[model samples]
Target: MSAIALTRRRGRRHSIRRPRTGFLLVLPAALVAVGLFVVPLVLAARMSVSDWPLLGEPSFTGLENYRAIAGNDLVGQALGFTAKYAAVILVVLLAVALGLAMLVRRPRRGVGLLRTAFFLPAAVGLTSAALLFYELYFAGLSPVDDALTGLGLIDRPIDWLGQPGTAFLSVVIMMTWRFAGFYMLILLAGLQSIPDDVYEAARLDGANRWQTLRHVTLPLLRPSLALCTILIITGALLAFEQFYVLTNGGPDNSTVTLVIVIVREAFSFLDLGSAAAISMVVLGGLIVLNVVQLLALRRER
Candidate 1:
């Protein structure tokens, strides 16, 4: 009809064609998310509402599992222990990782080697690392025990994972060793990204190392710290392998984490509905925590 109308129609056609290529490229990933994540999530939600035994017909239960969750003492203990463990591990991991990051952040001859050494444990599978530590803890007449005894650290061989306190501590040490390096890499990247001019300005302002770190470096590193905090908290809350392998929820089930509680409900006890309900609770809690963290950070920004 008109020249402008024709031009507008052609532009709309080109815009539609342009989006097709990107949409096609993203289709595979979308399908994967729906199949792997969305479908299982929906199924789990359904199972949570039904009495789904391991080998029985599913029947509608309608909030029975959720009701059980309220009166479950084991679940309460698991959540309490998990919270304490998460808090302790979060503090330890942040301190250790930050120390490692600062150590290797500066240019030095052996810096690469140090970074590699710190991060090498993270490359190993978590289960593998847990098993390895389990062996070390139980290895009888070994050098560790011998050295400790020889140095008068103990009167005799000590079972590191025998007591509840020591067993929890052992897991914490193993987790810190395994994950500190990974977080170090993240913090180191953040450290490197900080503009040199900022540090120069700090120095020019006569701010000493500690003062500069307290004022400038920490403020700049908040985002990375937040990420590391979230990861460490989530991992600690979901801790399963180390405690499962090492403690087996032993010492009167003192080291049972929230994830272990879920696994026990589902597989160990063959109560899928209860497990699904617990999982939903965990999922909701995590979502709330992450949302709060993001909102707090956004407000600060």
Candidate 2:
């Protein structure tokens, strides 16, 4: 081989080592994903097609569970409730998180303390927060009701989780309180990534706060907003602990969510096949939603 041919051959050989090194570096994570996620997913798929009882032998049930799911009134009702709850929670979460992001985006005296206070809720575990709120809203004996009554905010003790409307609102409120801060942090990072010079240019153009926000900040924040919205929607769809603990899907199963329904099927009623089928449906819906959202973001980019 000529000198140039020999050098190019050596370069090709050296280039091949990089990918080998990368694969070695990623092998552990790939193995972990296969073991933790892919394996369980495959097992769940198998269970979904089988009549796997809590105890006893399993038998193939094929699409029976899925067909039953299609005709199940309880599942329909729970799905509808879940959609409405998710919509309300998504709006509230995005609004609060964005408002917070804007509030603390600029540095002022005591801003650090304000940021800490706003972001503190995200640090609390969801289940723990639900339990804490459960105590505060424990019907007639709740201190919240007592305080509200003492302040004449109500004529008597109000049941925060007794009625359907109140139950839904209670869950939404708790979710907003728990997660708004986390989304705020996400939006804040996006806000900080924007060059200050862009804002200065907007100001120089005599743009007011609302106009600047509408034209500049929102356009720049679209990616972060999209991510936050996707996360909020997914989390809302998978809601369980708050409704499970606070209301127990009570007062006529008004607050039952999709995940709660799945849990009830699998554990409460010992219908593993139905639970697995419903889980697969949820997973499919989530995958479609995420794909659509990601595609839309890509188009915008």
Candidate 3:
């Protein structure tokens, strides 16, 4: 062959081999996803459409479980509570995280230490953090109550998790402490990605701190903000560990989240079919919410 034709043949062979190599590299991850996620999702869907007991052969039940969800008082209550909790957490978490990110985004003395301290709670496992807060919120052992009493704030120890409002507030506080630092890190990264030239131009244009933040910083930080919002909303909607450990959905099932209700249905009541139906509903809701959020937050080309 001529030299040019030989080169073309070699290029064609490399292009063919490149796709095979890429597929080979991706094959393991695809298999793992199919086994771990897809398989379980399929099983759950099947269980949702059948009368699946905890320890019996599942019989097809059509949409009875889904239909039952409409009349279930607990499900309605859980949905309302979850929506409220998600809204509160989304606001609190984003505000706290943005503040922390702005606080530590500038390079200065002790900034590294501050960042570490802020992020420390995020490194702790969620269950472990919830357990720690559980102890801290307990009546007699709680130093918070002791301090308040010592300061003469109250004649009695306040039941931090004993009532619906207090329980909700306590869970929100714990969640903020646990997740604020992580979201701060995300925002900080976003802040650092903003070019210094933009700030300098804003300053030259006589923009004050608030003006710069509102006009320049916020517009640039949209991606990070969107990510944090999505994560906060999703996590709050699916919250279980904090409420379970701190309140046990307690004093009157006031803090029962959707996930908690699903667990109760599955293990506590041994009604796997109903639990699966709830799970599917939650899954659908999450998918829809995420899609809406993405559409709302999509950056214009």
What lDDT does the true structure give each of the candidates? 0.92, 0.89, 0.92
> Better model by TM-score, 1 or 2?
1
Q: List the residue pairs that clash in candidate 2.
A: none
Q: Write the per-residue lDDT of candidate 3 for residues 164-259, one digit (tens) a residue.
A: 898899889899999999999999999999999999999999999999999999999988888888888888889888888989898798999999
**lDDT (tens digit, per residue) of candidate 1 on 5-123:** 87887888545467778999999999999999999999999999999999899999999999999999999999999999999999999999999999999998988899899999999
Candidate 1: segments with Cα more than 4 A from true spot: 1-25
TM-score of each: 0.89, 0.88, 0.90
lDDT of 2 by residue, 19-72 (tens): 778899999999999999999999899889999887788899899889999898
For candidate 3, list the clashing residue pairs, or say none: none
Error of 3 at 110 (Å): 1.4
- Model 2 off-target regions past 4 Å? 1-29, 139-153
Local distance difference test, candidate 3 = 0.92
Better candidate number, 2 or 3, judged by lDDT: 3
After TM-score superposition, the amount by which residue 263's alpha carbon in candidate 3 deviates from its true location, in angstroms, is: 0.9
